[model samples]
Target: MIAFDAFRDGETARRLAAAIAAEAQPGRSYAFMEFCGGHTHAICRYAIAEMLPANLRMVHGPGCPVCVLPVGRVDAAIAIAERTGVTLCSFGDVLRIPGSHRRSLLSAKAAGADVRVVYSPLDALALAQALPDRQVVFFAVGFETTTPPTAAVLARARHLGIGNFSVFCNHVLTPPAIAAVLGEAADRPVLDGILGPAHVAAVTGADAFAGFARDARMPVVIAGFEPLDLLQAILMLVRQANSGAARVEIQFSRGVTAAGNRAAQALTAEVFEPRAHFAWRGLGQLAESGLRPRPGFAAWNAETRFEIGDPPPEPRTACRCAEILRGLAQPADCPLFGSACTPESPHGACMVSSEGACAAEWSYGRGRRRIWKELR
Candidate 1:
């Protein structure tokens, strides 16, 4: 494992904080959205907003893989899991997410569905190899960071001549979601710049965001996950917003680059193609935002393997998760935030994952305000 302590240094964070304070425009609020759930967690965990000038704001976007997955998809996974002769394998993060009627894979497991949480796609592949008679489906859900692994597993299944192994691909692209946010800004809070996702950039490359930056006229700085990394990225964003210049910058030079991981990109391209449309939790149906198995991998696609029915859209409850995911609302602004939706009982998708904005705010920022008021 790499030693990341140098990037998380206190002096460096303070220095970046001071630089941001100096660069920020007085009396003008700068709203910069970080399009990664990991970034959101780092920001909230480190109280990055409290350290920043009041005029500067960090808007959370729908970058959390678990948080952005639509209820319908989760429902479909549950349906598959409950079927006879089918073994459903998925990442641990996805198992707890509630579907229609508040049903989760965990609950389905309790009711005797062969739902198993896996750490890696290889583990799911192994399960399929072990159970020759059973149809094993891996519930693959994530952004670009996790897609290549799914692709590799798919390729491996094909190479091994595994007929019973298949994947329920829910991998999504990041650029279209960014466009959706910028396009819908007229009715919502406008974003000045973006703090791009760390892992996504490592796979898709920093150059992938260049066109979006040009189109939206928004600065996107891809930063590492550390606190200091976030502070520096914020400083860069503040400087760009003040200058009215928009460009793509890479701050996480250690992991991400202009070209990114080409081999991984090639593997994903070979295995998957963009779906016509896919439903996101908050952003709704985004065109070419999702991926499905290619024609060569048709037999390995669970969508084609099984017959699933579409359920009507459920009524929007008091949960403001959709608004929060779009950066239009904060966790504190939601009526169900603390009262109806604590970390113990998350009422919406945002509260489900540790990286989620609501979970971060609730876990780190909840008692912080009262303490700050006391100190003041």
Candidate 2:
């Protein structure tokens, strides 16, 4: 077993902070994007930025699944939920995301739609077993890390011959999304290095990022979520940035390897195929970034079973969530950061998920920058 407490040791953090403040180049600036919600949460929860040098800064990426889910998908879930005797199940945070009509799963449920919060796809399968009279659709949404479990449950439902269980698959791929982000350099924020997502690496393998580093000429370090792991990864990235070397490195060796969990990847591939294109909230339509159920599994694909149509264009808002997701802006810069939008009453998807930049900033009071600018 791992002594997780060791990762959070205060003395270790202080030493690492001193080393980072010393090693990071003074005149040359380094801007790294952490491409995972777990990393963003850890950085915020531990006040990691306060230890950084003036020239170095961290940018949050569009890693939160809930934050990037397009409004049309949310509207589709609501459409399914509105049908008589149909129960739409999803993660809790997804319930609060406002859709095209400013409607949400929670609001739909309040209006007597059978929207349910399930912890896992297996739970949705079990719910379908229990409620044989109603159709149970798992409103599945996530990255590679969450895709395997949904695939596993689909396999289980097939084996058990569960007739009423289906999945509204909204799983997205990481590499394509990263490529999409880098491709937007002409208009969006550019990154000097990437603090790669460890959980995503654990599922897709560290090898998935090798092409990105070589092609984009960007340094990428696969990092664990712990504070110490993050600090070490930052040091490694700074070294690469200073040396003018761009390559893929692994700092979270404890959980990630070059090849990753092959079994999980194979399982996901067995159930899903690459979608031609999918629309993200900020990134628009990116080719092969999303996944759809294999046609053979149409019996359990909710999109095939239901008659959901394209939702109308979402009404515009003053929310800067689109720019924020592209690393072009911070939550503090948003006009609605605290006044019109909040966790209690979110005006946008970014405020709805705990991993979202807006929510993390609000929850952790990220405005108190003690070391980034003031001390330096």
Candidate 3:
């Protein structure tokens, strides 16, 4: 395991803040987006925003797989669970995301649907094996980091000839989503750099960011989840910007390598294939953004087993989640923020998932009244 303590000191954070403050160009802002919901949570939980220079700002991207899953998909999963012989399985975070008519998996479970929460795909697979007569559909949702494990489970199921096991693949790719953000309209703030997700890098490798760096001319830093790791990454980006250097840099070297985990990547390639297009709640349809089960394992695909179709009707109007995911607006800028959208009753995905930017803001009270009083 990587040593996480090196980046966990007050001195490191202060030094990084000073470096960033010194390099911030006058009248020019450095907008860096961290594409992982884990990073968003760390930023808010540690109040990293307040520690940065006024010219340096962090934008949240579509990092939370559960949050970005369209309402229609949730409804489809609910439908599967409601089937007489089907048992739907997913992470706990996905249970609360509202679908059409404000229905969610949690609510469906209360209505007698067999919706189960599993920490790993293997757990769901085992459950299917234990009950040979019942159909177990694992809701596989996540980025590259979570894909390989799911793939491994699928491979195992195939080897054992587990006929009742299937996967509702909602795995998404990171590169396409990054491209979508960079390709946003000119009116939006042009990002100067990106703090790439550390865990995702561990699976896809740090080298995957090179294409994005070259194409967008934006410095990409694979950052760790800890407070110090993020600060160091910010400082590194500031230095690169001040010196007019843009490239892919890895700050979380302890956990990430250039080649990444080859075994995991190979497993994912064998079990999952990229979809033509996938619907991201706020980013819309992105090419190759989602994954589907390979033909060799078609029998384990939930889409083929059920009549799932396109996404459901969008939530009510006035939800600024789309703008928020694109970095065009902040959570506070939304009309429903804190009023209609709280942790208890979230009007949008960003407020529902723990890694969501809006959820983090509310959880940590960043830029809220309490923090304002403390600063004053």
For candidate 2, give the lDDT of residue 88.
90
Q: Which regions of candidate 1 fall more than 4 Å away from where they truly are?
A: 1-3, 309-311, 367-376
On TM-score, the leading prediction is 2
Give lDDT tens digits, candidate 1, residues 1-376: 7778987888888888988988887979899999999999998888888889888888999999899888889999999999999999998869888787778898899999999999999999999989999999999999999999999999999988999999998999999988888885567668889999878999999999998679878988999899988998888888888888899988898899999999999999999999888889888888999999999998899998996544346458888989998999988888877777777777788888988888899899654464456569
Q: Give the per-residue lDDT digits (tens) of candidate 3, residues 1-376.
A: 6455766788878887887787788778888999899999999988898999888899988788877888889889988989998888888888888777778899999999999898888889989988889999998889998899999999999999899999988999998888888885676557888999999999999999898778778889999999988998988888777777888899999889998999999999999888898999888888888999999988888998885777754665677888888888888888877878887888788888889888888888764665456459
Per-model TM-score on C-alpha atoms: 0.95, 0.96, 0.95
* Per-residue lDDT of candidate 2, residues 1-376 (tens digit): 8899999998999899889889887788889999888888889999898788888999999998999898999989988999999999999999999897578999999999999999988899999999999999999999999999999999888889999999998999889878877885688676889999999999989999998789999999999888999999999999999899999999999889999999999999999999888888888888999998899788999989995554455556788888888898988888887778889889888889989988888888764242234437
Give the least accurate 10-residue stretch of model 2, judged by summed lDDT. Answer: 366-375
Question: How many clashes does each candidate structure show, in the order listed?
Answer: 0, 0, 1
lDDT of 3 at 244: 74
RMSD of 3: 2.3
In order, what lDDT does every prediction score? 0.88, 0.88, 0.86
